[model samples]
Target: MFEWPWKDIARECELYLGPAGFSAVQVSPPHEHIVWEKHPWWERYQVASYKIESRSGNEAEFADMVKRCRRAGVDIYADAVINHMTGIPGGTAVGGTSFTHYDYPGIYDFNDFHHCGRNGNDDIVNYKDLYELQNCELVDLADLATETSKVQNTIAAYLNHLLDLGVAGFRIDAAKHIPAKDLKAIMSQLKRSAYVYQEVIYDPAGPISYADYTPIGDVTAYDYAHRLGAAIKDKKMDGLLHIGENFPASNDSIVFVTNHDLERTGDPYILKYSSEDQKLYRLAQIFMLAWPFGYPQVYTGYDFTNYDDGPPLNEQLRTLPVLSSQNQCTAPFTCEHRLPEVAAMVDFRNQTDGSFVVNNFWSNNTDQLAFSRGQKGFVAINFSGNQLPKEFQTGLPAGKYCNIVGASYNPNTHSCPNMIEVNAQGKANVVIQAYSAMVLLNRTTASQKKKAL
Candidate 1:
C-alpha cells in the first residue's frame, strides 16, 4: 500500500504483524513526489523534495506510524529515494510543492543536478559503462550530483531527519545508479547509526557489482531471487542447494523471493502475486524462510493488471485502505504475507534464526528436498504434483511436533492436532503433499506440546 492508506495499515501492525513475528515493515517512500494523472507507482521513486510528506500522508501521520509500529516490536524501514529528483519538466508535487526536472523549490537547483553529456541525450544508454550509468539521468529523471560535499550532506540530512523520527533503517532506492564511494560518504555523515540496505541489482556481466556496496551496508541479493525462481519453476532442487555460491556473503546480503520491481518486470524468472502462481509462490517463500540465507524480506502488496497501475485509490486519487472482510484480504489488496501458510513460515524462521548451518540435507535426487537447521528445525518440500511419502533422517529429537505448515501448536492447551512423531533414532516417516511444505522445529512450543505416545 502507498499514500495515506499505509497509515491505517501501520496501525494494524500491532494487531497482526507483531504477533506473527515480523521484525520490520518497509513502508513506501515518505518523501514528496511528482503527481501523475493516473498515479503510477513509479512516481513515488521520482522524488520532488526530501520533506516527509507525500501521497503517503503528512509528516504527522508518518511519525505516528513509526511510533506505533515501533512499539509493537516492528521497526520501520523507509524507502529513501536519494539518487534523483522528479523526471517531469515541471509539476506540483503531492505535497503541493512545485518542481521542475532540474530544480526542487528550496532543496535542489539546476546546478545541484547532473546534465551528464552522454550519447545524444543526458539519459543513461550504456549500462556497461560505470561512469555513464552513475552520472547520466535514469529514465529522464534529474540525477543528483552526489560527488559534491553539499549534495552528500543534503542526502545525509534527509536520512538523519528520518532517523530522528524513530525510523530504524532505510531501503536505499536506486542505489546502483549512485557511485559506491558517494554512498559511503553520504552514509558516513549520518548523525546516528542506522540499518542500511542498498538496492544493487545483481548482474553477473554488468560493470557495477553488488560487492562494491557491501562494505558500506547490506546489498539486495537479486541473484538469490532470480536463481530460486528459476529453480522452483524448473523443479530442480539441486540448483538451490548452493544458492548463495556467487552472491554476496550471507551476512552482507538482503534476500527476497521477489520485490516491487521484479514482480512487475513480467519476467518468467521472477514470481509475482497472482492467482496462477500463488501456490508455487507461497511454496518458494516457505523454502526461503526455512533455508538459512540472507535476511529474508517478504513482499505483500496490491494486484495490478497493467505494469504502471498504482495501488487502489480513492475519489481524491489518494490510495484506498487495504482493508479485510471476515479475516480474508479484500480485492486489489493481495496481502500475501497474511496468508496462514506464509504466516506460519514466519514463525518457522523466527524459531530457527540462530541455527544457520544446513544439516542432514536430503532430496529424492529431484523435486523433493529436505534439510535441517542443525537440529533446531527441519523442513520437507514437495514441488512435484505427486505426494511424497518417505522414511527419512529427520535429525530431530523424539517428540510429537506440530506440522506448522498445516496447523500450529496450541501452547495454551499443550496440543497439536496435526502432529508428526519423530522416533528416538532421529528419523521419521512423513508424507508431504504436492506443491506443499512441512516444517518442524525443536526447542519450540510445538516440540514441548506433547510427547510421542
Candidate 2:
C-alpha cells in the first residue's frame, strides 16, 4: 500500500481510503528529511527543513494532493516531525537543502538545539528527570529548543503553510521530547483548529505524564494497545469486554491496534502481521473497528521481517504504485483495509454512530461476545479456537438482516450473500466460528440499505 508522491496517496484516498469509509489518511512527514541509504522509512523522521519535499513528493505536488483528497471527502493528517533534526550528521537533505547536525541553514543554528549537559552533546540516558526527557537529545537526534519564541514561530509557520494547503490536522511526532509549555505556545499560534494528535508514549513511571498533554489534543493510547495486545495474545476475549477501561475517555483518544513505530524499529510491543500471531493482530483490528470506543485507525503498510525495511519500491528506489488487486502485492504488504470484515465494520461503525452499546451477552466461557449499538446494529465476535453456537436477545424488531462480516451485502438487490433473521421477539440464533465476527444491521432497511452499504 506504499504510494509516494503525495499525488498517489491522494488517488488512494478516492479508491481505497475513502471508499473504505476512512475519514482521513495519516501520511508520513512531508518535510524534507535526511536522505539515507536504500531509503529507510525513518529517514523521513530526521527532518532537515519543513519543506514539503521528500520521498513522497514536492510542495506543489503535495498541495495538489491535498486539494484532490479534500474533493474526495477525505482529510489529511500530516506527521509533524518538529521534535528534533537528523540523528546522523546532515548533508544536503532529500530535497537538496543543505544542513549540518544541530545547524540547519536559515532555520536552526547551534543555539536552537539542546544538550542534556552543558556540552551540547548528551544523549537521553535517563527518564527519571523531567528536564532530561524534555531538554536532552532523544536517541542522539539533535533536540530543538522549542521553548524559545523563535523556534515556536518557525514551527507555527511550517504548520500554517500546511493549513493553507488544506491539511486537516497534524500528528505531532515525538511530542514528549518537547515540553508541554512549548507545545501549547506552538499550537496557540496556529491560525486554524487543525485536528491535533500528539505522540507521547504514556508511562506511569516516567517524568512526563499523558494528562498534561491531553488538554492540548488526543494522546496516542499505547495503554489500550498493550491491554488489547495482551488480551488477544492470551486468547482472553473476556478481558477485552472493557477494552477502553483505563484509557483517557472515548473522546480524548486515538485508539489503534498498532502504528508504524510499534510495528517497526526498536521496542515493538505487539506481534505484527508477519509473525505467528498474525490472526490476533487482524482480530484486534476487528474489535477496534466494531466496539464503540475512541476514533479508530486501521494501519496497513508493507510487511517486513526486518525492522528497517522501507516501503515497497522498484529498482530506482521510487515507491511502486499502490494496486487494488491482492495479486499485485509484490512485497508482503498486509493491506488490512481491503479485508471484507474490516470494510463491513466501517459500515457498521457509521450506522451505529452516536449509538451506545447495550444488551451485552457473555458468560464464563466468554469466548463469544454479542452486543448492540442501541437498536441500530448488532455484532457478535467469537475469538475462541472452536466454533460457537448461541442464541441471544438481539433487541430488534422482526426483520431479515444481512450478516455483513462473513458475507457481502448487495445494496442494489437489497440482498445479502448470506442473511440472518431476527424473529418478532428480537431473538436470533447466532453461530460464529473461531476468529470470526458476525454483524446484523437494523438501519439497513430494504429501501435504505444502499445508503448504509
Most accurate candidate by lDDT: 1
How do the predictions measure up, each by TM-score? 0.95, 0.92
Q: TM-score of model 2 relative to the true fold? A: 0.92
Q: What local lDDT does model 2 show for residue 29?
A: 88
Clashing pairs in 2: 5-56
Model 2 residue 404 CA deviation (Å) reads 0.5
lDDT (CA) for every model shown?
Answer: 0.80, 0.76
Worst 10 residues of 1 by lDDT: 444-453
Candidate 1 runs further than 4 Å off: 1-4, 324-328, 407-414, 444-453
